[model samples]
Target chain A: MYKVKVYVTLRESVLDPQGKAVQQSLSSLGYQGVEDVRIGKYMELQFDDSVTDVEGTVKEVCEKLLSNPVIEDYRYEIEESAKQ
Target chain B: MKFAVIVFPGSNCDVDMYHAVKDELGEQVDLVWHDADNLDQYDGILLPGGFSYGDYLRSGAIAHMSKVMAAVKKAAEAGKPVLGVCNGFQILLESGLLPGAMLRNKNLKFLCRTVELSVVNNETMFTSLYEKGEKINIPIAHGEGNYYCDEETLAKLQANNQIAFTYASDVNGSLSDIAGITNEKGNVLGMMPHPERAVDNLLGSADGLKLFQSIVKHWRDSHVVKA
Candidate 1:
């Protein structure tokens, strides 16, 4: 079995409103010195032993539909896991 | 004169869009669900603004994989017009219907206010009613409305006149202050404002009504014989 972790975020040059909001909240609570916040998303995909070439397939999915390369960036990691 | 509005699980602006088209154009409109498969009957499709699937993961990430998206793609390929607003814009980015993606607002707040938008391009079917550089007021309500694109693509958009609307002020951190864009064919438009909510003056402003009026007039001009 394989576990695929997908991290999705806006491109570095893009502004992140959610992350900035969270930073403001933290600062309001007296946690200072925080700067340059960026927000992202994480998704996990699990596959069984029958699947082949997990890395290539995940990369293709990310490029084709999972992520929009113009405004967002995505990377994936595979891990060995027990079958369901 | 058939129009359809796609409704995801958590779409709050579907009805507003429905009424906007129905009342303004005096046309029949259908509210299609996200799970529906067939989309051959509609002349146009509108993806209204709202927090789809409660914006799980990303604003439009999960909703991109809905069963109805296949139909949406087919319709788009057939040259039918598709308009995506706010959360709908996010879905268009996720579904690859349009370029770029939505980020959180620069202020990180759920901004809900009337904003000034300047029409950068009026060649699209969506913006044909507005003159180029025309300033209009529309309401924006979203947590993630910022738009980003690479420099090359931005240049391409500028060169091709694909940019439709831009914010008049520095409200959101959109690249080049872009608030809306269209596909290469100008049939698919995705923007980060709620035009449906601005259809009536009683609602707030009526500047956005011209957008829907443009679609109706375009359809008539394309199909109806002028005397």
Candidate 2:
């Protein structure tokens, strides 16, 4: 069995309005030292032991659906589970 | 010409599209479900606006994977005209039928209003009825209408004359003020503005009606023989 975690974020070159708005709110709340804040998505998936290539499967899902390559970048971490 | 208005879950503008083609343009039209895999019968395909799949994951992201998208892609490859407006445009971008992806509006607000758009390239089948550089009023309603693309893609789009319409003034902070663009072949168009919603004078501006007329005109010119 395997557990995978994926993080998808807007590319640095792409502007993130939501993140900027949050940053402004933080500044208003007196967090003057915060220079930047970028928003992103995190997803978790569980796979059964039958799945052989966890890394390949996670990459395929991220590239094909979870994140759009045109404006977003994605990275994933996979961990093997103890047999039940 | 027969047209198909693809209806994905949460698509709210399909009826407007259907009405524009059927009643306003006097053409045959039907509302097609997103799960259908065939789109060979339609001369033109319309993907309307609305939060598809509840805008989950991202606007148009989930909807792009629907079964109907394969048919949409097939129709586009077949050289049939495919028009996607607002969320529909987002779907086209997500599906890779168009070059750019949409970002949240620069102002971070859901904007809904009519704006002036300049016809950048009138030679394409979708804008042939309008004069070059003509300004038209179209209503736009979306939060993620800010279009983004790499510099190389922008240059290519410019060189190929694939840019169809640009906002007269910056409305969404889109790159190069691009309001609409067509595929390299000029057969598929994805735009933030809702032309279907402006097809009648009662809808505040009939400027959008000519777009549908232009599509029909092109189809007739190519497929119908004048005896």
Candidate 3:
């Protein structure tokens, strides 16, 4: 079995409103010198080891379904399961 | 003409869309489930606003993969008018039928209010009834309606006159103040506003009625016998 860990974030060119809001809240809470905070998403997927080209398949899935290329970017790490 | 208002599991605007088309526009309109196998009988397709799949993965993300989306895509390729509003707009973008994607509102709030929209391109079937630069009142309700596209795509849209509407005032902090845009062929339109909700004067705005009229007008004009 393969365990895929994916991270997705809004592109730098696109505004991160939710992240910005959180940054403001942090400032109000007495944090100092906080430069900026950009929020993102993390996803995990499990696939059977019978699958080949695991990396390539994950890449295609990320581009097609896991992320919006127009506004977000994504990268994934695949790890083999000890059980399988 | 017949219209199909696609109803996803969590779609909230399908009924409003149906009312606008059947009672207000005086046309045949039906609510089609997202699992339907075909859409060939419809003259136009409408994807209404609401949280489909409870907006699980992303706005319009999960719904784009629904069974009926393929039929909707085919309808678009067949040159039938396809309109996506609010969540519908997000679906169109997620499906890649329209360029650009949506981000959270700049204020990070769920905004639901009426705003004025200026018709940037009145030549398209969706806006032909309105004069260029004409402002219409429409209600926008969504949390993620900030539209974003690359500079190159923006240049192409401007060159093609594909931008259909711009908010007279920046209501959602959308790039270029864009509220609605059409595909290269102008048959597919995706916007953040709810025109169906504005069709009745009882709701305090009938300005959006012209948009429905424009669609009917264009369809009729194209179906006419050539001289």
Candidate 4:
């Protein structure tokens, strides 16, 4: 079994309005050295023993549905799970 | 003309769309569930608003994958007019039927009000009844109406006259104040404003009714030729 952790974020060229609003509030609260902030989504997927190539599946899913190619980018890490 | 309003599980505006078609426009319309795949008989397709899939990942992200969308794409490719409003607009963007993606409104607030829209292109099937440069009132209700696209795509949209409507004033911080746009073929349209809700004077403005009328008029004109 493999456990995949996927992270998705807006591309650098795209603006993150929510993240910007949060950053402003943080700065007003006196958190110094805050250069930038961008909001994103993270998901953990569990692949069963039947799945042979974890990386291939993760990449396909991310590109096809998880992350929108026009505005967002995603990366994932795969780790072998001992449970299954 | 026959119209199909694709209803996703979390869709809240399906009734309004049906009302606009049957009651206001006096046309044949059906509310097709997302799971249904057959839409070959429909002359036009409508994707109504509200939070599809509760807009979890992004607005319209989940609903775009419905089984019915395959038929929607086929209709678009076959040159059938497809109209998407609000969340429906987001779904069209995610499906790549139209270019550009939506971002949260710059103010990060859910704005609900009637906004004035300037008709940017009237040659398309959706706006043929509207006069060029005519200003109309349409209600907009959403959190993610801010439209974004790369400069290259923007240039292409401009070149092709794909822009359908622009806000008379900056309402959601959309680039160039774009309120609605159509595909290059001009068969598919996606807009943040709710034209279906404005089909009658009781709802404050009847300017939206002409849009539906225009779709039927164009479809009837072309279909009659084949017969």
DockQ per candidate: 0.58, 0.91, 0.87, 0.76
Tens digits of per-residue lDDT, candidate 3, B1-68, equal 99999999999999999999999999999999999979999999999999998998799999999999
Query: Which portions of model 4 miss their true places by more than 4 Å?
Result: B225-227
Residues A1-82 of candidate 1 have per-residue lDDT tens digits of 9999999887787665667778888899888988767778788999887878888889888887667676678988899997
Top candidate when judged by TM-score against the true structure: 2
Model 3 chain A lowest lDDT segment of ten: A75-84
lDDT of 2 by residue, A7-60 (tens): 999999998889999999999999998889999999999999888888898999
What is model 3's DockQ versus the real complex? 0.87
Docking class of 4: medium
lDDT of 3 by residue, A1-84 (tens): 899999999889887878888888899999867869999999999988688889999999999899989888998898888764
Off by over 4 Å in 1: A5-11, A15-44, A64-67, A82-84
Ranking by DockQ: 2, 3, 4, 1
Q: Write the per-residue lDDT of candidate 2 for residues B1-227, one digit (tens) a residue.
A: 99999999899998989999999999999999999999999999999999899999989999999999999999999999999999999999999999989998999889999999999999999999999999999999999999999999999999999999999999999999999999999999999999998988899999999999999999999999999
The positional error of residue A35 in candidate 1, measured at the CA in angstroms, is 7.8
Best by DockQ: 2
**What does TM-score give for chain A of every model?**
0.89, 0.95, 0.94, 0.95
How well docked is model 1, in DockQ terms?
0.58
- lDDT for B225 in candidate 2 is 98
Cα misplacement distance, residue B138 of candidate 2 (Å): 0.6
Q: List the residue pairs that clash in candidate 4.
A: none
lDDT of 4 by residue, A55-83 (tens): 88899999989998888999999999898
Candidate 4 lDDT by residue in tens digits, B1-227? 89999999889999999999999999999999999888999999999999989998878888988899999999999999999999999999999999999988989999999999999999999999999999999999999999999999999999999999999999989999999999999999999999999999999999999999999999889887763
Model 3 spans with C-alpha error above 4 angstroms: none
Q: Give lDDT tens digits, candidate 1, residues B1-227.
A: 79999999999999999999998768889999998999999989999888899987678888889999899999899888899999888998888888777766776678889999999998888888899999999999887887887788888888888899999988877788999998888899999988898988898899999999888888888988989
